[model samples]
Target: MDAANLDRLVDTDRVHRSVYTDPAIFELEMERIWGRAWIFVGHESQVAEAGQYFATTIGRQPVMMTRDEAGGLHVLFNRCAHKGARLVGEGAGRADKAIRCCYHGWRFGLDGRLLSIPMADGYDGTRFGKGCPEADVQPLSRAESYRGFVFASLAAEGPGLVAWLGGAASSIDNMVDRAPGGDLEVTGGVLRFEHDSNWKFFVENLNDLMHPMVVHQSSSLTARDVAKAELGPEATMPPALQIIAPFTESYRFFDEMGLHAFEWGHGYSGGKTSIHAKYSDVPEYNAAMEAAYGPERVAEIFAVNRHNTVFYPSATIKGPIQTMRIVKPLAVDRTVIESWTFRLKGAPDELLRRSILYCNLINSSANLVGPDDQEAYRRQQQGLRAEGAEWVAMHRDLGREEDLGEGHLYAKGSSDLAFRNQFRAWKRYMAGVA
Candidate 1:
C-alpha cells in the first residue's frame, strides 16, 4: 500500500477496520515493522549450552538462534545454502560440532559460517565458492541481549536494544531484580495457544482493563464462588484464586491506578492492590531480595506492582507473576501465543510454584481466562468482516491525556490511552518513520 492508504488506516483517536482485517496491510506490517524492529527470539537460558539452537521467526523468515562453541550467541536464517532446505527442525536441539543439511549434507558452524560440503571434488575448478557469502546460512543484520532476553533486527540500522526500550527497560529490570541472584530464567515449559483473530487484538488486550470486568465476568465469578465454597470466608484465598478473581474488580479501582505509555508502543497499567501481596508471605524470598539489594531497594522493587507490560507487537510480560505471552502472527486472521513462566534464581521454590500455578490458571490454552478472551477476539474478527462498521472507536478519555514528557502519556480516567498509543506507533512503523 502507498503512504496515503497507510495514513488513512490509522489516526490519533480511531483506526479503520481494515487495519486488522486486510491481508495487504498485514504483509506491509511484516515488511516495514517486523522486518526492522528488534523482535524477541528467545531467552539466553534456553541456549546456555554450547551448540544449542532454538528455531524461531523474525517476521515471515524462519530463523534460528544458536550458541557457538565458545558460548557466543548468533541468530541466522534457517536455510541450507546448497538446496534451500531447512537446516534444522522447529524447536531446540544440539548442532553437535556443525549443522548438516538433511537434504544435501551442506555443513555450517554454529555461527552460520560455511564449514564444509559433501562431495567436495564435484565442484573442482568451478566458481562455487568464489565471492559467494550467500552460500552460507545468512546471519541477521543485528542481534543483542539485555539481561538474558535476546532480540534480533533484520535491518542493519536502528536504535540499539536499550535505546529502543527507553522507559520500558524498567519492566525487564523489575523482573530480574526480584530474584536474589539478580537473574531470571525461562523454566518449566511453554504453553502454545492459537487464536483465530488478528495478532494486534491480543496485544491491545494486554492492558485493556475495561474488558476484564465484562468479557471475563463468568470465569472470574465462577472462580470466586469456588474459592468461597472450598475455603471458609475468613480464610486467605489461594494464590491461584487470587489471580483469577481479580478480573471482577470494579472500574474505579483500575481508574485510580495509572497507565504508563512509553515510546515504541510499550506500555503498562497497574492497580493499587498488589497481586503478589495477596499471597502468603515467603520470608525466605523476602530475605533473599533484601540481602541482594538492601532493604530500601527491595521495598521499592516490590512496590511496583505492574499487571502487564506490552513490549510492542510481540510479547506481553506480567512482571508481578514472572510470566510472559509471546505473539507470533501467522496470517491476518491467525496468531499463536507462547506462554512462558520464569524461575527466579536464588528465590524460594514457593515463588516459582506460584508462577507456574498462575500460568496454568490464566495463561494456558485450557485455562478459563484465556479462552474467554480468545472467544471475544474471534467474535470481533467475525464482526469486523461485515460491511457495517468502518472504524473502531478509541475515544475514551481521548483529548484529556496529559503529556508527561519523555514519551509518556497519562490519563486520569479509565481510558483507551494504550490503544491510541499503540496505533500511533503502528502508523509510524507502517509509514517507514519509526
Candidate 2:
C-alpha cells in the first residue's frame, strides 16, 4: 500500500479494522515492523557454557543465539551456508566444537564461521571457500544485550538497544537488581501459548487496564473466595491469593497506579504499585538483598514495580515477577506466545518458586487469567470481520495524559493511551519511518 493509503488506516485515536484483519497489512507488518525492530532472542543463561545454542525466530525468519568458545554471544541465521537448510532445530543444545548440519554434514563454528565442508574436493576452483564470508553461517546485522537479556535487529543502522529502551531501561535494571546477588537465569522451562488472533492483540493487552476487572472477574473473585474459605479471615495470604486476586481490583486502584508510554510503541503500567506490589514477603530473600546491596539500595530497587513493560512487537516483561512472555507471529491470524520464568541467582528459592507459580497461575495458556484475555482477543478477531464498523475506539482518557518528558507520557491506568501510542508507531513504521 502507498503512504497515503496506510496513513488513512490509522488515526489519532482509532485505527481501521483492516489493520488487524488484512493479509496485506500483516505481510507489510512482518516486513516493516517485525523485520526492523530489536526482537528478543533468548536469555544468556540458556546458553551459559561455550558451544551452547538456543534457537528462536525473529518475526517469520528462523534464527539462533549461541555462546561462542571465546565467551561471546552471537546471533546467526539458522540456515545452513551450503544447502540453505536449517542448521539447528528449535531448542537448546551444545555444539561446542562444531555445529553439524544433518542434511549434508556441513559444519560451522560456534561463532557461525564455516568450519569445514565434507567432500572438500567438490569445489576445487569454485567460489566456495572454507573461510569465505558468503560460505559461512551468517550473523544478523545487529545484536546486543542488556543485563544478560539478548535482542537482535535485522536492520543494522537504527538506534542501539539501550537507546531504544529509553525510560523503560529502568524496568530491566530493577528486575536485575531484585536478585540478591544482582543476576538472573532462565529456569523452570517455557510455556508456549497459541493465540488465533493478530499478534498486536497480545502486546496491546499488556497495559490494557480496563479489561481485568470485567474480563477476569470470574477467576479473581473465585481466588478471593477460595482464599477466605480455606484460610480464615485472620490467616496469612497464600501464594495463589498474591498471584490471582488482584484482577478484580477497582478502576480507581489502577488509575492511581498510573500508566507510562514511550516512543516506538514501548510502554508500561503501574510504576508505583501493581498486582505484584504486595506479595507476601519472604524474610530470607529480603535479608539477602540487604546483605548484597544494603537496605537503602534494596528499598530503592523495590520501589519501582512496573506491572508490565512492552518492548514493542516482540516481548513484554514483568520485572517484579521475573517472567517474560515472547510474542511470535506465525501467520496473519495466528500467533504463539512463550512464557519463560527467571531465577534470581543467590536469592532464596522462594523467589524462583514464586516466579514459576506466577507463570502457571496467571501467564500460561491454561492459566485462570490468560484464556479470558485470549477469548476476548479471539472474539475481536472474529467480530472485526463485519463491514458494519470500520474503526475500533481507543478514546479512553485521551486528552488527559501528562507528558513526563524524555519521550514518556503518563496517564491513569485505565487510559487507552497505550493503544493510541502503539498505533502511532505502527503508522510510522508502515510508512517506512524509523
Candidate 3:
C-alpha cells in the first residue's frame, strides 16, 4: 500500500476495517511496524546458562537467542547458512556445543559463526570461501536487554532500547522491584493461546478498560458469585476472585483510575493501586520488600501500581501481579498469545504461587477470564468480514485526552484514547517516519 492509502487506514476517532481484515495491510504491518520495532524476544533468564537458546520470531524473521560459552548473548536468524534450512529447533534448550544442521551437517557456534562444513576441501576453489560473510548465520540488527527482559530490533538505525522504552520502562522497573532482590525470572512455563482476530485487536484491548464490564461480564460475575458462595458472602473476596471480579468494576471506578498514553504506542491503565492491593498483601513478601528497599522506597514502589501496561505491537505486562502476555501475529485473522508468570527473586514462595494462580485463572486458555474476551474478539473478526461495517469506532472521550507533557496523554479510564494513541503510532510506523 502507498503512503496515502496507509494514512487513510486510521483517523482520529476510528480506523478503517481494512487495517484488521486486509491481508495486504497485515503484511505491511509485519514489514513496517514489527520489522522496525524493538520486539520482545525472550527473557534473559530463559537463556541464563551458556549454550542455552530460546527460539522466537520478529515479524516473519525466524530468530533465536543463544548464550555462548563465553557468556555472551546473541540473537541470530534461525536459518542455516547452507541450503537455507532452520538451524535450531523452535523452542528453548541447551545448544551449547555447536549447532549442527539436520540437513547436510553444517555446523555453527552459539554466536551463529560458521564452524564447519562437511567435505570442505571440495569447496576450497569455489566462490563460497572460508571467510565469506554469507557462510555464517545472520544476526539481527540490534539486541539488548533491560533488566532480564530481552528485545531485538530488525532495523539497525533506530533508538536504543532505553530510548525506545521511554515511560513504559517504568513498568519493567515495577515488575522487577516486586522481587526482593529486584530481579525476576520466567518460571512455571508459558501458556500459549491463540486468538482468531487481528493482533492489533489484542494489543488495543490491553488498555481498553471499557470492554471488561461488557465483554467479560459472564466470567467475572461467575467468579464473583463463586467467591461469595465459598467465602460466605461476607468475607473479603479472595485474590483469585479479585483478579476476575475487577472486570465488573463500575464505570466511575475505572474512569477515576486513569489511563496513561506514552510515546511509541506504549501506555497503561488502572494505576490507582497494585493489582493485588484489593484483596491483601502477602506478609512474607511485604517483609522482604521492606528489608530490601526499606519502608519509604517500598511504599513508593507499591504506590505506582498499574494493572496493564502495553509495550505496543508485542506484549502486555501486569507488573504488580508479575504476569505478562505476548501477542505473536501469525496471519491477518490469527494471533497467538503466550502468557507467562514470573517468580520474583528472593520473595516468599507464596508470592510466586499467587502469581502462578493468577496466570492459570485469567491468562490460561482454559481460564474463566480469557475465553470471554476471546469470544468477543473471534465474533468481532467474523462480523467485521461483512461488507456492511466500514469502520471500527474508537470515539470514547475522543477529544478529551489531556496533554500531560513530554509526549504523554492522560485520558479518563473509560476513554478510547489508548486505541487512538496506538493508531497514531501505527500510522507513523507504516509511513516509515521512525
Q: TM-scores of the models, in the given order?
A: 0.96, 0.98, 0.97
- lDDT (Cα, tens digit) per residue for candidate 2, span 322-403: 9999999988789999999999999988888899999999888889999999999999999999998899999887899999
Clashes of 2: 0
- After TM-score superposition, the amount by which residue 178's alpha carbon in candidate 3 deviates from its true location, in angstroms, is 1.2
Q: Residue 365 error for model 2, in Å?
A: 2.1
Off by over 4 Å in 1: 130-132, 271-277
Tell me, by TM-score, which candidate is best. 2
Q: Which lDDT tens digits does candidate 3 get at residues 1-434?
A: 89998888789998998899999999989989999999999999999998899998887789999998899999999998888998777778886689889989988889888888888898888888457888988899999999989999999888899988888898899899878987898886789998889898888877878777888878897778878888887788766777778778877877777899988999998676533457577888888899999999999888877878999989789988899999899999999999998989999888788888888888898898888888888888988888977999999887898997888799888899899999989999999987
Model 3 clash pairs are: none
Clash statistics: count for each candidate: 0, 0, 0
Candidate 3 least-lDDT 10 residues: 270-279
Model 3 TM-score on a 0 to 1 scale: 0.97
Ranking by lDDT, best first?
2, 3, 1
Measured by C-alpha RMSD in angstroms, how accurate is candidate 3?
1.4
User: Global lDDT of each model?
Assistant: 0.86, 0.91, 0.87
Residue 51 of model 2, lDDT score: 92
| Candidate 2 collision pairs | none
Residue 121 displacement (Å), model 1? 2.9
Query: Across residues 74-138, which tens digit of lDDT does each residue of candidate 1 receive?
Result: 99999988878988987788987899899877888898888887777777787775236877788
TM-score of 1: 0.96
- Candidate 1 lDDT for residue 160: 93
